[model samples]
Target: MTLKSPISIYDAQGLAFGILMASLGVTFLKAAALVTGQTAGAAVLLSYLLPLDFGVFFVLISLPFFWLSWVRRSASFTLRTITAVVGISVVSPLLGAFIRFETLPPFLAAILAGACSGVGLIALFRHGASAGGLGILALIVEERTGFRTGWFQMCFDAVIFALALLVLPLDGVLYSCIGAMVLNAIIGWNFRVAQAMPAQQVG
Candidate 1:
């Protein structure tokens, strides 16, 4: 098969918006003392347990996924994925400075965080990039089996949350479960819509 076209400058620009939205969502999650799944979720867990920065943990966790992207996708794709991961790491921490929440209800934070990050992730996927970790595997599985990437991501998130239940309080894990469902649902719904439509239109 021929190689897919490299992402254009426009799509790269689009990834920035995606990264920003995803970062903002994570910011909310952190503020509410919630943990998610995927690379972002892992970062949240580590940030809670360690003195490390969330962004730093995010980028560090993403490193292993680069090999998967390179082997399954393309060099261009791997590069863009790297950029997206780094962008998220850098922006997530900075977002706290500009946006402060005095008291965000856990349920509200979960839903809103999920929605925002889900939209951001969709944008990254469409542009041939991801936030790394299970996201890379999700894309690969989706491309092969026509499975929903969101479902694959959700499965990964489930495992993370199962572990999270051990580390986080009951309420936090409960809210996280809700947020994970919302996040994956958005991605699954939108991905189905994209598949049903023409590529040009989806873009």
Candidate 2:
């Protein structure tokens, strides 16, 4: 699509598919007892500590970032992000019911989860939306500083992994690192911040 083109029904379908793939990645991580990074990681960590589902924590934690998104991006972008966040929050939980991984290896789960999430994020970026949380920050930083969004997220993932250590097994955290690397590498190498979307209606 050209920079001048408007968002169409096809774009909506793409956004929906992106959300589904991202939610599937989350399901993989949850099944393997591994948390990658970003708001999804925080939601998973919180879900482990509390008595709620990942969906509840995912939406609740992402709420504050909406304001940040509004200030940094556009209203449309912010709305798209909110919708995407809610969509993942709703879909991810239901996935456990339908698609259960009886004995998923954490190492394998990490690779699959990272691949799914990376491609899914590319789709969202193309549509001028994100999964909320640090994703918004990553985009803003990239736009302003010419920094790669994936690298920016990798820095944040460091802190999340450190915290994960306290809550998760050492081996699990190590495997999670592999997933985070794969996720960031895909984004850093593929999605350039400047050409992420069109200036017109990508958001």
Candidate 3:
């Protein structure tokens, strides 16, 4: 494929995949009463604290980080992250309105949401893009420290979940932490698998 055409196609697919992942991530957060880290976690915390739409809050919180990504990372990475961010910002509320689970248990919700979010995250990373929250921060940390970003991300998520406990009930906080753990574990496994895969296979 020509450079222009291939890049265009990749962007389109990445956008779709990013939206799906982010939406599922949000769903998991809502269901399990969990938070990730950085912007998205901030958004979730703010939404719980204040009366605000999660999607709007998420985009507003991510703007500064988007600017930071542009300065710190490649233009392509910035562009891809921006696309994913916008897509998630737009789709999350719509998904929220359409999908309702009145009876699902919290643990099951956590497991399913974590799995879906993980799959979505793997798709975004494979496409040279991201879901643009803790994921971006993790990527940056991994590039700088050579320590596994997944573990770093988990630490941040744990802190956020801990703070969340102060705001929410103890049980809710516990479940949320569990959900975060599952999500981060999936992220760690996916990253290692990606690293293990041959360059030719990944390409």
Best lDDT goes to which candidate?
Answer: 2
**Candidate 2 TM-score over all chains jointly:** 0.94
Q: In terms of TM-score, which candidate is stronger, 2 or 3?
A: 2
Ranking by TM-score: 2, 1, 3
Compared with the true structure, what per-residue lDDT tens digits does model 2 show for residues 1-203?
A: 22323557977987998899899989899899899899889999999899999999999999999998876677778888988999999999899779976588899999999999999998898887899999998888888788999999999999999999999999999999999999999999999967767574233
Backbone-clash count (model 1): 0
Please give the lDDT score for candidate 3: 0.68
Worst 10 residues of 2 by lDDT: 1-10
* lDDT, candidates in the order shown: 0.83, 0.88, 0.68
Q: What is the TM-score of each candidate against the true structure?
A: 0.90, 0.94, 0.84
Off by over 4 Å in 1: 1-7, 192-203
For model 3, how does the per-residue alpha-carbon lDDT over 1-203 read when each residue is reduced to its tens digit? 11122456765785687578768778767755666555677777888888887777887877777666666665566676777777777777777778787776777776666677667666666666666766776776776676665677778876777677778888766766666677678878767533632232211
Error of 1 at 21 (Å): 0.5
